[model samples]
Target: MAPTPCITVDHLTVNYRDVQALRNIRLTVQPGKVVGIFGPNGAGKSTLIKAMLGLMPVVTGRVSYGEGTLARQLDRVAYVPQRSQIDWTFPATVWDVVMMGRVKKTGWFNRFSAVSRRLATEALERVGMLEFRDRPIGALSGGQQQRVFLARALAQQAEIFFFDEPFVGVDQKTEAVLFKIFQELAAAGSIVMVVNHDLGESITHFDQLILLNKELIAAGPRDRVLTRDNMTRAYGGHVGFFGHVA
Candidate 1:
């Protein structure tokens, strides 16, 4: 039998007032895998992420972790929100931001101690941002900011990670670096899932793809589920042809 999935969603549904954002969403994400969720704007991609984290209250159904529920296992997961969602002008150093990840592990009594500082440093080093650790977050470029957020997640040392639109405005070099970091995370047995919109080109970097258009259109290995037929179905049959990757 297949290894038990690290995360599972069963018959999940969400709504905003009378507007249905997600309808009967279901998926299982295995450990050490890189999964991509692709869809156009207003396709409920963000709603899925928010609902899983309890950022969006669900109207019906359940979101579970492994066989247990999401509420009990919040510490095992780390979230990296879309770059656009954050306020860059926040007065915090890169190191300070990363150190926030250790808050859960430090518990309620102990303050951030030497061990927490070390872990923060290590997370910055892992993301190649240690040299800029002292810099204020507002001083960094777009790519550097993205790296900092990732380092924050790394510092959490969680088994599962959720990234929303990580490549939205990154330079090509930053995109490449992020991909390398993702591969490393997966190799080390962590689940790395990202929500992206650049489907025609971004599918090459993913091992599995979950297509969404208010519901799960298709999900499986990249080569099997990202074909033209499925693409047409998901994107309304009028997508522009971007040349294939050689």
Candidate 2:
């Protein structure tokens, strides 16, 4: 079999009202790698992914997956937004949330198939949330909530995964579980991209890095993109390497 086609962003640009959020961004996301988007506050890390997925309006350029644009293949993409963006008290059970992932496949106004239910159950079990399936989403801890969302994504069985700030506020155990699953997904030939703000040890988990500061600072393997000069350009100062400050 031939290699899977990579996701490509060509001369992408996005603006928010009068403010430019991202400018002339270009990158290729290959299958079977965990690519991290890193930057300072308001550096457009989230904006870039959203634009690539066509969740946000792009002022210029385009994002293509294989030979097709992302907008045309959204069913193959799974996105988990920041925890802060979700309403915890939405009167939904954990099972309800996870099953939502099947909506695209199940079709509107159609009941989920038995296979879809089985997939959702397996996803919850993988994330260790099966026992709490009937519990309200609001009753879960921060880590539990994140795990539930992850389960939802897994149930989607999407080829491309986009996670925005998945590590923020999650417990250490959740972080470990999440990274393990991410590695598994990459190993299985999926595209995984994470938008992360932490400039600490967790940065080591990514195979590739896309450093941004309202524009493309650098994009490559972690070692090549995490250089001192790139860090200074993206963050406007020196950042600690590994676990030590410069």
Candidate 3:
């Protein structure tokens, strides 16, 4: 595999109006791995990703990819915001939502090329949502909806993928599908970051873990980050659900 630029977060801080959310976060995330951001509620796990993507207001810090800032190279990024943030009532078909991924390259109001259609179709097929392509996105089950979004992200063919709470309402099958594709992306040298809350066996799927609680706690290999001390610092109590930790 060729060398690729790792994601660098330096002295990152975020404030929500008058309240500070994250402070002085610093980490380096390499490609070729599925990185999980784990923390208790209001711990700023999602804030970190949003700050890195420039979606949240950052008071200090820089997220760099290679020689340039990540915000400046967004075309190479794929993001799936939390499900609650999405408007489920939106009247868009599964195919329409998947095709939207090509908008950045195909441009708005322009016809999509055959290649774009092929990519979108293949993405849907990979996610097992091809048969539901014509169904309304709002009408699908929670797992089905999540699969469609995954397909949409796949259609974008991005080098960096950020998922916020993807498994919240998904079924076992959806979770399995997600991890399978995430491993594939990492194997292909793409950066895959997921914001997850579960501390069960599912935690073992991540190659690296980022633990936070309004600030950085630990980050590195799963075993290193999920140490008893690290877990206590991040969760403020004994974590009993994650079986893989020491």
lDDT of 2 by residue, 144-200 (tens): 998999999999988889999998888999999999999999999999999998877
| lDDT (C-alpha) at residue 87 in model 2 | 91
Per-residue lDDT, model 2, residue 121, is: 97
Q: After superposition, which runs of candidate 1 have C-alpha atoms over 4 Å from their true positions? A: 1-5, 108-111, 240-246
State the C-alpha lDDT per candidate. Answer: 0.82, 0.90, 0.91
lDDT of 2 at 107: 69
Q: Pairing residues by index, what is the TM-score of model 2?
A: 0.96
What digit string (tens of lDDT, one per residue) describes model 1 on residues 13-120? 999999998989888877777888888888898889889888878987777876778756878888888877898999999987888788865664543788888888
Q: Give the candidates in order of TM-score, highest first.
A: 3, 2, 1
Score every model by TM-score. 0.92, 0.96, 0.96
Per-residue error for 121 in candidate 3, Å, reads 0.3
Off by over 4 Å in 3: 109-111, 244-246
